[model samples]
Target: MGGNGKHRWKISFHRPSSSSSSSKMEANHHNHHKQQEEPPKDFLCPIYGALMADPVVVSSGQTFERLSVQLCRNLGFSPKLDDGSIPDFSAIIPNKAIKSAILHWCDSSGVVHPRVPDPATVEKLVRALMAEEEVYPSPPPFSSPQLRVSERELIRGVAENPPVTFSHAATELGPRVNHFYSSSSEESVVITADNPGTPLPFATRPLCYSSSSSSEITESETLASSIPNSAPASEEEDHLVRNLKSVDVVDQEEGVLSLRKLTRTREELRVLLCTARVLLALKPLISSRYAVVQTNAIASLVNLSLEKPNKVTIVRSGFVPYLIDVLKSGSIEAQEHVAGAIFSLALEDDNKMAIGVLGALPPLMHALVRSESERTRHDSALALYHLTLVQSNRAKLVKLNAVPTLLALAQTGSSASRVLLVLCNLAACPEGRSAMLDGNAVECLVGMLRRNELDSEATRENCVAALFALSHGSMRFRGLAREARAVEVLREIEERGSERAREKAKRMLQMMRGRDDGEDEEGDWEKALRSGGAGGVGRNLHGPNSTTF
Candidate 1:
């Protein structure tokens, strides 16, 4: 027994033939053939109504009573008998031993957990369990529906961190009092997270946060640091939601989602809500003032990335730091989700600096130090590319020691585009360009591209364009680009990108390979003139009216 006399009983499912089980059997056939084995026609327990391959296994007489209690409870009986005692499930045991044996063989106790049912079996089970005689009203009106809205709020707010006060907008919230737990607590409400995994004062009724996907705390933090006592919980949830933008992404269609159901696995709900939140937040339609609020709000979702659920649907949650930390927790799902999140984030710049701040680079770089996946290696480098775009961020990138790791990434097959971008951006900066040009990066890029290992056509173009970025604008990269097959790769890109990814790659390639043939091509004199303004780089990028980058 684990908790509350709950015994772990594996109910073997008997079927005419279960394909999943057959497949499993077929997979294990090699081992089975080597040994003498017969079909698993197991034993039956007449008392508890169970089947087993071995009679040595103990019969679960008490288990039936417990299960009956649970089923009766679910079926709207308090399972406390009409006499105010626990039901005597001995009510189910009056049959002769032979009759009991037959019942045991029938529906008494074999369950393939997580298995959905055949329509016939489902219909039969429903019909049997729901005979007209078993029909009951909703528990005799249950004391005027005594469960009030404030009590619900008290339950959830206390559950939020436990010991919740009445002031979390306690005025007549109704069932929506669960909003904070739903929206604010981002951890997927899976069984493990919502259960007694984290130490809270109350163990019988779940309270406080779930076991998070991040570093394991010796103890959970004080709730005061997390939820605010004074926030008008329900009002805040509705007011800010109207402004988010919607992009027509090619994903699962809407209306297929069942977000309203209460039992759809807590983490799944978390993932769905999180995806909804982020997909909306990214577009300009969202109010800028709510950016930080939304960002903090979604950070709570970080815990679900470690659940090993297919994060692909909710991948847009932009939980880079959370996922990265999850990977650090030594969870396989964490590593995969972190990989997925990094790959997803590099597709845009919205959360780049925040990702850099989330302490991703050090762990990512550490993983990349020896990883062989070109995909993983490439995404890691790509994330660094976005992180380096901000000047303040450049220091952290350097601190993650990504330059050397990025240089190594260029040597891998999948990293050509990322390598070119990183090298180009680095060269565009005074120190970064100096580091690449004066060192081994030039030869490394050339070697990587020429090896035929860099399969991505975009990488080929980026390599060429990076040569131009290195060679043209700054004297430092200009010297390095010429040394790194910049001319050859540029020609390749001009030919391929036109028929390939269109003008974006081609225009960039052309810009890097520009000569003094046109006014635009002659950027130096214009750039020098542009530098006379106070904004310098800022003006050169965005005009005088442009907000600070």
Candidate 2:
């Protein structure tokens, strides 16, 4: 009986006939293919080319994987997709709906759920895409004839040892006179290189003039003679670089001052002077105890950073930490220049994270609140506004208890417009929203709106936008809005505010009235928010007239 039972079990596991086996194999192959099917196009990130685990909507109203957006922003490379459209990553908001749909689809379709990719792997992919975009078709062969011997010799000389100073370059170039004008209110002076002639485009703030007569000069003659008139531009640059690297305080001061003047107004010179040699030389001088050397060195960096390409270069050279150090303890004038440099450097997408990571937020906040110079405060506010656009910086600011300080500034109406812009960015994140609500931001913003205390239409728009961001899915927002009488203020805004502000106010009122019933209203709110929030303010704030040298 035991043998018969074992035989029966073995028979149950035996293979079928070949024909039957082939049919079963075919069925299983079809099922396997079905299981391996691709996901819907909407579920995939344009850059990642995979189902998105954490989707987010960017400033352009397009959804992408959050990691992909971060990588692109960090790389400062906006890629063009297959459809030939470039993404704008200026701001991003979580797309929970899309993320949910993706996960549900994966479950229903028997596809494995997606996971957040390794950051190292994602960065590699982003860099590969960047490399593709940077590749351009080679230019056609040059049609011009070969150069003469003197021209070649001149080019070789420049390549070997460039000009030492702008004045020296002007002297070597020819008889044309160079006029140096101060951008400040101080009286401008035209230093004639050879003869009085047409004015060059270069201009800068006034430098400290030597008080002694030419006949009385004695100690600085060796330094003065170093920059000869016959040197080319490359040689002149080298000479100034040597002075910057010199041990003597006077040489360092003169080099930085000359560099500051050289880069101030000449856009071409700013690009040329932003080399590694010059930046490295300017590094130590940034922290010099001599106020003149420190201020001028930082000011020169600010000038170099005005060039778009040099922004990232300056940050990568490790200037941010030193800038923060000076911002904390330097003189008021030096802090003004440091703030400006920080602001200018933060304009580049690549430098934003690095700057914030190198510990710029606390000192920047301090400058925004405590600096005596209005320019310092203004620049600090703008720097904060730009820096907080990145999510990491926003989180860091919230951790530093920056929301309350910022709200205090807004309530007191000191730089209210700029301060509100920073608040608007912070309100986009969950941590920031909780912090602001805890800090009674709804009351403060509502009060500002009720009293018409905001500085401009754009400022009021940003204020409404902040409240709008705060109202998203927060149980605390409704009660807070009621306590602040936000409905009346929003109604007034809906009736009289600018188009963007009116739309946002209407949405906020809907949420308060429990009429924000579906995704349609939410979608409209996203549209309104996307069109006018920090992105719009950024355009106006960084416009042509916004910044000056």
Candidate 3:
């Protein structure tokens, strides 16, 4: 059992047979005839129990049908092995050798095999499952009121061992809380209510309040009044809201934690990435007044957004503005969560500019400038790093005074690598490089190299690239690079760094000595001038912005 006693049952789905499977079977039958021998179990698909076609191997060293594994993934479940461990779909490799072996067996046996359903039909079934039309509720007040067998068993267990308050137990049961009935104009006054019984497992007596009207006392107030409390009306409402919100917060937290833990399991993470329940539930709660609730919700969204499928889901939900609002007014912890969520979503190439268009930079700059938490500062810079990857986003970020802020962070903050990457991106533009030079970024670059606080080759590569840009700007800049003992560092990098780094270092060294290394540096310098500026040369240099999640 996991959080809230909710067990994540594996989704059961049958694989669709494809034309490929059928053709292979038919081809085997048309071959040589001989006495049939039993096919090895390894040659059979674990799900369909048939001769394997397009077999694939997983990390667990077990092979299964490709279509079957894909079907299981589409069903939001992992292929469960006999040992009960579910392997991630990405870890599964196509086993062409096993497939060939199965083909040989089928040809030698000359036995007729059943025609499997077309692979296209199987794919359609998978798409339907992925769309979740039949599994989960589409709208509120689900038509199918009956629960799953597992859910019903859990509910019956609760009914048999009833809680002290039937209302509390009813609340505990995971039923959709529809406001439809409560919001209706119809008012049915109960004369008297029955006690706990067989059919109605538990009953509740309405709170004895004077009959004013539904307008005077809201449903939540009525619920609060039913509980034994001696506070004034205002206090009662607050108490009720706090209790309700607390309960909601707990449920949301459990769901968030479940998603978090599910990410550790490859197959479970795939399902979580595709499932919309957590995203839908958390989106509405980002505006929650409670800091803890908003933080947990944003944290969950951040985790989900790390996956490609979930990243699009989050961005499409129109959450960037909401997240920006949280950054504006949320607590430090909430701001950190919001920043992480933003960057995770921005990983998608399409979302890079959308985040900038939504005005995410202001709050991000705010966090970068004033946040007391180093982690918050780092996260803000990281988010800005991804957002600035696009040309338009880079302009927006620099226009918002992001360059100076990032430079300041690089100088004294713990986010040296994050700030360095963003600086690297901005350095590709003329105005960005000028801003770096004006912000004394060369000194910070030198200090970073000297201090070696962050032992990352990527960071050093970025620093060298920035210095190279500044060194080419003017004689004074070249003098500054030399004063920072850049020559020694460049020599070491030219000797010890990667091939690209060595090439860049050699150019920088030749430039410092008032000599042209060759036509290569001349073309590069002209290209940098024409293209605005240069980025880090090493492949691993300044890879995607660092993220805490």
TM-score ranking, high to low: 2, 3, 1
Residue-by-residue lDDT tens digits, candidate 1, 1-549? 111122223344444443454577686884464233222222322122244222221111112222333344334432211111122221222223333443454453333222222335323332343352343324332311112233234335434653212322212101211111212132112122322232111011011122232332211122212334344244333323322221211111111111111112243333334333333233221121222322222223322222333232233222343355444543332243345445344333434444554456677666455444433454455455555665545666554456676776666534445455655566555566556655567666656556656555445544544443444445444445566655565455455542322332344345545533444533642342123110111121111111000
Ranking by lDDT: 2, 3, 1
Cα lDDT, all candidates: 0.36, 0.67, 0.54
lDDT of 3 by residue, 335-447 (tens): 76677677657666667765776677888888877876555665677677667777877777777777777877666666565577677778766677777777777777777
lDDT of 2 by residue, 150-234 (tens): 3234345545765443221111101212232233222222223432331211112111210122343223333334434443278
TM, every model: 0.36, 0.59, 0.47
Instruction: Give, for candidate 2, the lowest lDDT window spanning 10 residues.
Output: 2-11
**Cα RMSDs, all models:** 24.2, 17.6, 21.4
Which runs of model 3 end up more than 4 angstroms from their true locations?
A: 1-281, 447-458, 469-485, 492-501, 514-549
Candidate 2, residue 371: lDDT:
80
Which of candidates 1 and 2 reaches a greater lDDT? 2
Model 3 C-alpha lDDT versus the unseen true structure = 0.54
